[model samples]
Target: MSSDTQQGRFEGKIALVTGAGSGMGAAVARQMAAEGARVVVLADVNGEAAAAVAKELSVGRAVPLDVADGAAVDAAVEDVVREHGRLDVLVHAAGVDDPEAKQLIADALVEGRPPEVTDRLGDSAWRRVMRINLDGTFHVLRAAVRVMRPVRAGAIVVIGSSCVFDTPVGYPHYAASKAGVHALSQAVAKEVIASGIRVNVVAPGPTETGMAARTPDVLRGGFADPRVRPYATPEEIADIALFLASDSAANLVGAVLLANGGRFTA
Candidate 1:
């Protein structure tokens, strides 16, 4: 489906993608296969969904996993290693969004808010958001690097949101966590360069995916801007993912590449 596949850069390489059931995760899984990866590990909480995507590609296997569960993540990594012999690539693409819950938290951020109105920053909803996006990311990376380090080679590409910069007023927790991701990725890249592992992040802006389709109607109308007519397709974002996964970006490490479509001026 891509020139990458025809070129066969990933002909014998194996890749593991988290949240491969839907959204950017599914897109990336497909793209990785297209690039000729002999084996791919599709990991997601939704086992059936992951299997379906992996089945569509037909060059990979799926494993139901929750990145939030460290033990589960560890076991899944082991499974991939057992089956593939080594892990060369890891992509973190699963995440969740709840604008309403986030808006409530943002409201509390307003000064003079009643003490009774606790902030969502530390609430259950916020905790879950951070747990999945932040803690889960860390958990997956820890496990991936463990396998990658010994091999003295690997590439980690994480899916981040462009919202981290031009973020809406609501999701402070999500933004903060993603911000932490970029910083941590840079720090980890520096720490692991000597180990022969590379870490980088891709920030996709307003991608056309299941996640965008499910965004509330109120949110959809905001896309009517004439200057920003079309949303970037998941495949376009996957192009960046593939480049990051390949030797094209071999010199890249601790880099945060933004793929947002002029949503915010640099």
Candidate 2:
């Protein structure tokens, strides 16, 4: 958990993690709870999954939410604030990234085959991806800022994609959505900085999550090429997210921290 055994960085704090059912989100929630957060809300679209994760953490509470709905997002935030009294840390991790579909596209490209029109960044796929990744980020960010700005102190860590930098082929929709997220984060960071609220992003490359597990072996090998390196564990991504949310990054605002192994360089 970030290798900072010093603990208490988040003691007495309240953290809300969207997509806390699994992957990097769950890892962040666990790490924060270990660091002494008084409360951690596990917000996810999958209520059962969220409940399962919450059952493992003493301070965890599962809240089912769909970030695409503005009203639902607002209500969810209100519930957290009412129960916890304050939201010191927020990790936005809920977004759509269908590994199976992504892997198919990658495999086709590698084999010099033309992807099916319907499956290759079609209008339907584009809209679905954008609604979840782009629109969802907007909904949650707006809801959080409304509550946090008044308090004059809060931290928001957005989970973006390394696709913004790598810009790989076959997944135009995914890359576009994540790039939009980075832009949104930067703009919001500037708008909220004066209010004592910090907003930053974490752009992670392929990691050992359900999303990446569906990739073909050949494609995975390319990702692990000597220069690019192999996939990272969810824990590694969680560590970076924690660091950005912690006071250690007080001087940083609107920064996109990369946790993509060696996929992108300085």
Candidate 3:
């Protein structure tokens, strides 16, 4: 636990975090537990990974989930509510960046070849990214909303990408998916606020995570500039996410907070 943790900030809160197997999702779970959440359900596609992180928490449980599967997502959320009685917080962070496509573009750039990544993009690649990144978000968000609506009290913080604003040449599909997430979050926020649910987005840029680790050196060279920091740590992003999920951000709803370390000011 960090010294700065709000100590019991989330006491008695029941929280659910998707993608909790690693990266920002795992960080959020840890912090929520440290802050005294009653229970933090860690859901991920990788059951073992989620269970590993669950062991680190005082009140954590692991649930294997494929966010792309709407039925499974709904069941998972329903199960949490049924077991815990109520859900107070939701952090939807499960997503993909399509490392294979990125690698292809990187190789082309290195070899001085036309990197027509989009032109060569097959249906499988495009659909896979959309299914996991965009469709999965919808599945999770909708499920959370269904339960939270009746309770008339909840907080949702979605992990979006700065790529949505400043398009990345290597990841059109990722950018598009995140854009949909941002828009969906805002729209849903408006609908749910009257019912006492708060929804917001954290759009981060080049975070240091497993996803970023897979990025080729050719594409990661920009981070080498000494004038600017390379990437935000998972903890840093988690801090913002927790803030949105906490009472501290009560005034925030449908807001997209960008954590790009000044990488994109606009």
Candidate 4:
């Protein structure tokens, strides 16, 4: 959507973007369409939202999918290939965070009290996060690999969190889930590179998205620094994802590119 976007970079490529209903996923889908992707399948749990976003693309369609359901994930990827002939790119952006838990921690931080979010975390909450974030990523990535391995040509950019590098307080489950995604991506990247498939991770920090908007101001304030903006835009993050999924990053395999402004240096 910018002048610097490489026109036709994805010409003849078919892309599948999870969490495409909103946030960074939608942004990636939009950019892929702009860059001439043959077809961009917008898959999300929120079917209506995904459909709304798909209406904006020339060759985009909505596919209702809950990535937590491994069987459904496999079916969705198989359907995409069956419909489009080949799967050239995949951007796994579907993930979850406990905003209520984060707010509780932020309250404690503001009140000068020790944050004990994990102690209060229930088994259901923890499992829900892991199911959607870690397990969901595994399912989607595995599905993509199945389709791409035979073709010996494809790119995958999984959306991880900067928390993998610097774990944030009150986000134990979220951080752990993203860490799993990061590790899984590297392991699979090594296994698939020989097959001509490149798998990479984008670890983004505080970005302007629905999730970030839900975060308390007290917590967001911690990210404020004169050196860089407090938050990156979804479109900005999408640019990084799109680059990784394109030939521009052909040599980058198992690389975790951080897009957290200047929050973390490692």
- Winning model by lDDT: 4
Number of the candidate with higher TM-score, 2 or 4? 4
What's the CA RMSD for each of the models? 3.7, 1.9, 1.1, 0.9
Model 2 lDDT per residue over 181-220, tens place: 9999999999999999999999998888766776677667
Worst 10-residue lDDT window, candidate 4:
1-10
TM-scores of the candidates are 0.90, 0.93, 0.97, 0.98
- By lDDT rank, best first, the candidates go 4, 3, 2, 1
Q: Write the per-residue lDDT of candidate 4 for residues 174-194, one digit (tens) a residue.
A: 889999999999999999999
Better of 3 and 4 by TM-score: 4
Candidate 2, 145: how far from true, in Å? Answer: 0.4
Clashes of 3: 0
Which of candidates 2 and 4 reaches a greater lDDT? 4
Worst 10 residues of 3 by lDDT: 221-230
The ten-residue window of minimal lDDT in model 1 covers: 111-120
* lDDT for residue 113 in candidate 1, whole number 0-100: 57
> Best-fitting candidate, measured by TM-score?
4
lDDT per residue as tens, model 1, 7-102: 577778889999999878888888888778888889999999999998898787999998889999999998889987999988889777765653
Name the lDDT value of residue 36 in candidate 4. Answer: 94
Model 3 C-alpha lDDT per residue in residues 1-266, reported as the tens digit of each score: 34588999999999999999999999999999999999999999999999999999979999999999999999999999899998899999999888788888889889888667888788999999899998999998899899999979999999998888888776788889899999999999999999999999999988888988888998888567677777889999999999999999999999999898887675
Task: Give per-residue lDDT, candidate 1, residue 243.
Answer: 83
